[model samples]
Target: DCEFLGIVGRNGSGKSTLLKLLSKIYTPTKGDIEIDGSLVPFIELGVGFNPELTGRENVYLNGAMLGFSNQEMDAMYDDIVKFAELPEFMDQKLKNYSSGMQVRLAFSIAIRARGDILILDEVLAVGDAAFQKKCNDYFASLHGKQTVILVTHSMENVMAYCDRAILIEKGKIIEEGEPAKITEAYLKLFNLNS
Candidate 1:
């Protein structure tokens, strides 16, 4: 049941659209899409964050949206802050936080939230290198333990984390196979298109 799948393609090639469909943020206009488990989507980080609210407050607010009760959020609150490396900034208003700070907090919540599947869109591109390494290590650990659907342009990421991958072009499946082959084909698309 655990599978790490990557969707790779050029910009505007429906990679994000596919994630939306999977997360039910967009219903497919055509075929039936079925998902067997609950999904926690990190499609647009900081989407629901409020500028006026303190980070601590927003954490609780966002946790509620994910269907976590106060007790549950309380249990996870420390880990979330710890992971985001924002322990000192939690009481500060979100508007005062830098863009990097905001994204780290959002990413932390997405990873820590309980769900059967994780839907991510360019999430690894965020933060500084150290944080990115943390993220990479986290995904590596989840390799055979979690079902993750990642939409990314980083061929390195596809090669490193994906068990399987699909290359999308112009809103269609161009290829589906091993991560290495799909990434190689994805790179070739640039030469062919140009």
Candidate 2:
């Protein structure tokens, strides 16, 4: 959201909350968070999803949250499972699904719903190595076309995906710059690399 928007910091640095605030999932205590366009927050897809509901049902529900209608979701149904690679279990209740499956479905839905601003948490890590690579590839394909904010503890991944990183400490920004330098500072400041 700034000149250098990647965020890195120690535990409890309000990084998640910051994304929550920007996505309107959490209200700031003092100031109103402002963004000029449509915003979508990619949270854990299983958090509020009904486990008893089939993957098909969950797709529409998650789509609604992302501002898509049933017809829209229907159009994207095949794409979602293809991206998630769980086409075989599309009719099963999500409760019968594994955590990875749930995450896959959730992420698939999130990825399909277009937005002007996209905020991604660490939820993508729930997938296996192969799926993570797929997600990364999809993210790269969207590079510079849509405004994307990625939140993660993996400095290497952040460095690879983002051009700039911002360091936050205890709810306030402490530093901001190119991904390499800012991540280095964050690791040293937090003793993360040691």
Candidate 3:
């Protein structure tokens, strides 16, 4: 299905694979993806960041990686800095930042890119309680406003946030429907087998 939706399941249940397929990071073995425009993927937080580079520099670096020109990134650089809430620390080297700080900056850059579609694969499960809360609030705010696809084992979050969900198992969707019902089915089936 080519719908912007939720992909959910327990570990090793192909949830991440489904996200990769949609992101085209790993193309489907036998299929064609013909999206109308660019689909930016934030599959891994801070994955492309150069540790030696300053956060500000890495902002441009990530923008370039996402195929944006220097001018484009420069235009949105302030917003990115604001969204990440790291105005003063922009000049610091990435390696010197804590893991939580890195995640904050990376997620800020990725989400602010705001491409045609967003495929979030557990990227929000970073930082401490406060940062995680901020991330959750950010995701919550995006509800119904943008086209996004989320994959996480946080059933409560799914139940609270997602409108539709598709349960994946072993590289295929086993169930697709309302979040509450689909999640119940997943847990029930998994419990029976376990």
Candidate 4:
């Protein structure tokens, strides 16, 4: 079923590992995963970007990696640029763009990819406060309408956006339940009273 699920844990607690496993970037050593439909993983920003290539070229390149054709990328190009708010910089080489600019572009492209499931890792922490709010709004629009598996450290995000959540520790799921309860449990581990 389509749902918003949050995964939370301390650093190096396998939250990202799980997302990578789901995204097929890392094959589990001893497990199987069954996904029912298409998935898009916004795991690492600027993953397929070429430092030598212009942002416009990188857009098509990244789109191709996401299984989009040139024609399809052409259709989404304008929207992607608009969302990134980098219309004037699309012709600039990726190496010349700031980290934030690159992240904005990559994130813009990732959200454009249609998928049954979307796996995001730390994307909410990208950009400045205003951009983060935009990300928040985008997730708000997807709540209950699309399947999203988000890995984040923000309890507020878990409570605000996730209906269900899981807490991971040392590479295993230690708890799973309603977002509020799961977040409370997670805080308890850190001696924090939520």
Candidate 5:
């Protein structure tokens, strides 16, 4: 049941849209999507976070949206803050946080929460280099152990982590195969479309 699948495409190619459909954040207009497992989607990280609220408040808020009870959120609060590396800033307003900080905080919460299938949409593109490495390592560790749907522009991620890959163009899957072939085809799109 565990499959590490990668989706790659240029901007506006429906990569994020595909993730949304899979996560049920968006309903498909013409097709049926049958997901066999529960999934935690990290789409547009920090989408539910309020700029006016403190990071701590946002954590609870975000957690609640993800179906966590207050007690559940309380139990995981410390670990989430620690993982975000923003223990000191938890009490501060989210608006004060940098984009990187916001993303890290969102990512931390998502990682700490429970889910069988993890759907990530460009979540690897943010945070500092070290944090990126941490995420990379986390994804690597998930290989063959968790069902992960990764939608990234990073070909490096596809090559390193994906067992199979698909290339989407104009809201449709144009190619599907091994990571190397999909990546190569994806790169060629730019030259051809340019």
Candidate 6:
């Protein structure tokens, strides 16, 4: 079991597409995918969110979409709000929140959900530097305990967090091995060196 696998590739090189396929957001044109356990995907910002709804309401809505009960959401509510650092703004409509705030709330909710495997796409692109460090710490904490499939372009992130990695190009995996090695090959694709 690959506990933490990072995917790295250039833009439009099918990295996000691969994550989408794994998350069931898109069906593969051909071939099949077999997943052995429950998964949580944080593919896009505000995916299951309604802009007109209050942040508190959206939390419950998102939890429900993830197969969580109201009681479960209630139990996690405080933690989510605290993590997002937006407890005061929970009553406000999501549309009124800044993009950063919206992403923070969405990410907080997503991370709270239980899952055997977590699929993330460009999650590191969210929040400010301080919040990004929080995200880094959170991922660091999950190092050996959780199964994560991450899509990112940052070689530093790949080297820092991943146990294994793959380089995809044109919808096919061209390299797979240690994070450092995969990242090296990814760099060469763009005439850059690690």
State the C-alpha lDDT per candidate.
Answer: 0.91, 0.80, 0.81, 0.91, 0.90, 0.90
* Tens-digit lDDT string for candidate 1 (1-194): 79999999999999998998888889888889989998988888877899999999999988888889999999999999999999999999999999999999998887767899999899988899999999989889998899999999998999989999999989999899999899889889998896
Among residues 3 or more apart in sequence or in different chains, the pairs in candidate 2 whose N, CA or C atoms overlap within 3 Å are 6-166
TM-score for each candidate, following the candidate numbering: 0.96, 0.90, 0.88, 0.94, 0.92, 0.94
Q: What is the lDDT of candidate 3?
A: 0.81
Kindly list the per-residue Cα lDDT of model 3 for residues 1-194, writing each as its tens digit: 23446778778988777767777778777878776666767788777899999999999999888778999999999988987888999999988988778888898888767576778887668777787888889888877766778888777777877888888777778888998888897888789978
Candidate 5 wrongly placed segments (more than 4 Å)? none
lDDT of 5 by residue, 1-194 (tens): 79889999999999988888888888999979988878888887888899999999999999998889999999999989988999999999999999999999999888866788999888887799999998899889888889999998889999999999999999989999999999899989988997
Clashing pairs in 5: none
Model 2 residue 56 CA deviation in Å: 1.6
**What are the C-alpha RMSDs, in order, of all predicted structures?**
1.1, 2.3, 2.4, 1.9, 1.6, 1.9
What's model 5's lDDT at 194?
Answer: 77
Which stretch of 10 consecutive residues in model 1 shows the poorest summed lDDT? 106-115
**Candidate number that wins on TM-score, 2 or 6:** 6
Model 2 — TM-score against the truth?
0.90
- Clash list (residue pairs), candidate 3: none
- Candidate 2 local lDDT, 80-187, one digit each (tens): 989999988989999999988888888888888677877888754768999989988888777767777888888876787787878888898888889989888987
